[model samples]
Target: MMVPEERRNADAERGEMPVVQGIPIGAPQGGMAMVAFTTLSPEEQVVLNYRLAVMCFAFLDFLTTLLNVLTAVMGTGYYWWELLLLIFLLGPLSGLLGAKHLHQSLTAVYVGFCVLKTIAQIVFAVYFFWLWHILFAFLQIWITKIVFTFCRCLSRIPLERRAQLLDLKEVELRMVYW
Candidate 1:
């Protein structure tokens, strides 16, 4: 029912297509190319989200390490002193490395931290047997489970869905060697 002029005007207002040589560009040269130009891929978003999570975890690790050191310094018992030192050494080290490597590498430092925490929790369960220690053990297990679940879900996402979600575009021009 709408005339060509009206359709062109609507397209211009929406920024859906570029103006080409005074004629409204229909679609990009390729559908995939247009999509790539428009949206961030889902994988990119997931990577970014993972980076943010790592940063948050690193901050928490730093705080926890500091608290542990303070508790140890307060002479809370030799066991507490040793445990706190271990936490101080590993927690901040792994956290800092994970945060620093996030953009450049997909290291398993976070997973390693979780594994170390789990081992520590098991040790606490056997030696301390305190309610707080038990609670912390369970919490670490839960966090590990959740992280694994998220990774699994990300992997299960269909390629097409990922493309649509991520707005991935195919490579266009071939490179020419000089």
Candidate 2:
């Protein structure tokens, strides 16, 4: 077995963070600003993955809202009421607020709103025979799933870890969510 000093030197040469039991104990040598991926706990990994998915969904939601506004302005489709709803309850803003504060209640409210919004979209699709509405409904469902999954995984991580994740400074204390 290699001695501790030799192991440290080898790891340093390889540009790897020093870790113990899969958790990073300190910053990498030479002042590297990246933590090894293996240093994250399983729950953190899940949260990270879900957070990315949620962001993508949020982008899609924004795109759909934009398209609706364009169509309404052009007088091709009367989406005035729908536009009002989207503007009032923009999913991404609520999600970002909840995530930044780590407030489970706000996130839960967001999930509830998403669920209701999805149901309304489905009903509108069926009643109005709008194929595009169906697609948007499906997107909303996916967004809801991603946000719910992220929130569940976030809840599993300790408050201290979550605080560290929000630091956004040093690699050792930062998470990839932002």
TM-score of each: 0.46, 0.58
Full-model lDDT for every candidate: 0.54, 0.65
Please state the error at residue 44 of candidate 1 in Å: 3.4
Give the alpha carbon lDDT tens digit for every residue of 44-147 in model 2: 77765565465555555556657766666667556556557456346655665665566555666667767777888889888888889888778777777778
- lDDT for model 2 comes to 0.65
lDDT for 65 in candidate 2 is 59
How big is the positional error of residue 141 in model 2, measured in Å on the Cα after superposition? 1.4
> lDDT, candidate 2, residue 138?
85
- Residue 138 alpha-carbon offset, candidate 1, angstroms: 2.4
Which run of 10 residues does model 1 get worst, by summed lDDT?
169-178
Q: After superposition, how far is residue 170 of candidate 2 from its true place, in Å?
A: 5.1
Q: C-alpha displacement of 63 in model 2, angstroms?
A: 7.4
For model 1, which pairs clash? 41-166, 42-166
